[model samples]
Target: MDTHEWQKSSYCQEGEACLHVAAVTTAETVHLTESADPAHSILSTTPAAFGALLRVLRDDDRG
Candidate 1:
């Protein structure tokens, strides 16, 4: 998928800094970056790895 197609997350408000996530069209990959500094941040990982990261974040937040 074109990196340009990656839109900002709904949770991100126009006046606030946040992150964005997008799915890669050619593979089982996802891309992520900071909305405020797209050029300075990039993360590419498989769906499973991304899911695992989410779980870890959620678990960490609960603790």
Candidate 2:
């Protein structure tokens, strides 16, 4: 497994339930994981897919 410099989401609070992201540039993958999961089940996807997901989420927030 590739190690990454994970970044906590700005929306995360002071608790275990949190969102984290890491961009693996070398592999062209965007990694996502929740801080609350002890098993650390990672979700890796292409940059384009990640961007699309973010865009959809942003639009949904406004909807």
> What is the C-alpha local distance difference test score of each model?
0.77, 0.91
16-46, model 2: which lDDT tens digit per residue? 8998999989899999999899898899899
- Residue-wise C-alpha lDDT for candidate 1, range 21-42, written one tens digit per residue: 8887678888888857746577
Q: Which pairs clash (backbone N, Cα, C closer than 3 Å) in model 2?
A: none
Residue 31, candidate 1: Cα error in Å is: 0.2
Reference-based TM-score of each model: 0.68, 0.90
Number of the top candidate by lDDT?
Answer: 2
Tell me how many clashing residue pairs each candidate has.
0, 0
Off by over 4 Å in 1: 1-7, 10-16, 38-41
Clashes of 1: 0
